[model samples]
Target: MYGLEQYLLSMIYHYRYWGLFTVLSFGMIGVPVPDEFIMAFSGFQTSIGHMNFVKTLFFASLGSFVGMNLSYWIGRSLGIPFLHRIAPFLHMNENKIRRAEGWFQRFGDRLIVIGYFFPGFRHFVAYFSGMSELNYARYTILSGIGALLWSTTFITLGNLLGTHWQGIIALLHRYLSRGGIILALFVGIIYLYTSNRNKAKTHEE
Candidate 1:
């Protein structure tokens, strides 16, 4: 396990931006690569002048966008059967899948915007969004925002921490879930407020 991680790190060191992109894209597809660690490492690279911050963030976001959309389309086209067959291979558990579905039920489409902060949640949420037949354009917009927010949060941390990033990485992962929940609820509240206001306006007219 450690060897694979070291190899991935070496890849990032040698190949720079593309390596980071490839890792994040496959990680989104449930490839077992360490997505957050690599992203933070990429940020560290930027600090050392091995990579450009803008380019790294752009590619990381783009990779996640591509991989997630692929998952969405796969779930939409093949439905549950493909996920059932591949779930074992991909290590996707029922509890996690069910949890994601429940969040979708409770939060509606807002989960897609902040799901990226919760590690594997983003993967399953994308599939649920497609299976639930959420509009593609809407999904894309939320996923894009998620990908950007996720990239910026971790990569910036990595860049800022420099040598100490590894120590705080685990803490970030631990706390990020709570932060995501708060943000999701905040967005949900705003959405509800706006929707109610619009309805009231229409009724008044």
Candidate 2:
């Protein structure tokens, strides 16, 4: 993680706004860069007088918004074909996409917000949002708000924690991993229950 922190610091030190923006833009598009860590580090820089707080916030928010919209556009344009092409890499298949579609119909908006908090999985939210053809206006509104909130929260923490930011990042990563597992299990249980209830209703009818 020290290596990651140094890499991010180097990017910010060398390229300033463009570096941060570029990394986040691509990171959100599924590149392997540490997006949240970079954001938080930018905050840490701000705390140390290396970066302007307002500009860092603006660029981070913009990068996140644009990257997500790009994903959405890709999903809208390519639709299932895109998913089919990339699904293998994502460990997604037709059945999973269909299942996700059902959940999107039921809880799409909330997922957009929740997705921001989940690493790895958040990369797919914009694409799935596009494929699902969620209400465009709402997608924009919700995703925009989510990006702002997500970026701000981490950035502020980085600023507040300063030198201790890395510790928090490590801790947060562990909690997020554990939380993701619990959330997945919960979602699976609900899905099974819903499927069974639907099956029973169909039989009764």
Candidate 3:
């Protein structure tokens, strides 16, 4: 996981869209990959004429959506019985699952969408949503919207920052463990604000 940037850059340099999709899919599956950095770096590549912007966004969103749903299905199919059987080995228990369920209840469906922005949260959101028996329709809608907002933010940052993305990403990586949720919230706000502005412009036009 450490010193991954060099390898990620190389993969992006070679595989392009396929590389983007593969990395993010696994990252969301709990692999220790720098997903944000990958998207941002892809954006940087797009800005420099090394990749296509629309494709980057498309694949990034697609990879995340697929990965998240996969996690959800695993939880759903595996169900509680399986987890309970394995819990002791994994150091998880019914108590912990119930506690997480409480948080989900308080937050409700919003977690599906917002979870994408918060790194580790996304994986848990999908898995728990399934374990909690959340409706597939609601899960898809919330998760899709969240994935779009999350992917576009970092991708746009990459494009806008261009050559300077690495410095910003380096700074972000340093603070991510502490400020991840805060940063996710900030990005979500930006996404909402941008969407509103665009809607207003369309209305005016």
Name the candidate that leads on TM-score.
Answer: 2
Which portions of model 1 miss their true places by more than 4 Å? Answer: 80-106, 175-205
Tens digits of per-residue lDDT, candidate 3, 65-169, equal 888888888888987777688889978778665644554554547767756766676777788777777788888888788878889999999999988998897
Q: For residues 1-205, could you state the per-residue lDDT of candidate 1 as single tens digits?
A: 6799889989999998888888888888778887888999999999999899999999999988888888788778876556567778877677544544444555657778767877666776787777766789988998999899989998999999999888798688667757756665665576556556756998999
lDDT of each: 0.80, 0.80, 0.80
lDDT value, residue 129 of candidate 1: 76
TM-score of predicted structure 3: 0.78
For each of the candidates, the C-alpha root-mean-square deviation to the true structure, in angstroms, is: 7.5, 2.7, 11.1
Candidate 2 global CA lDDT score: 0.80
Clashing pairs in 1: none
Q: Answer with 2 or 3, whichever has the higher TM-score.
A: 2
TM-score of 1: 0.74
lDDT of 2 by residue, 53-134 (tens): 8898988888888888887877788877776788899888787767667777687667787777777667667887888888
- Residue pairs with backbone overlap in model 2: none
Model 2 ranges off by over 4 Å:
1-5, 81-99
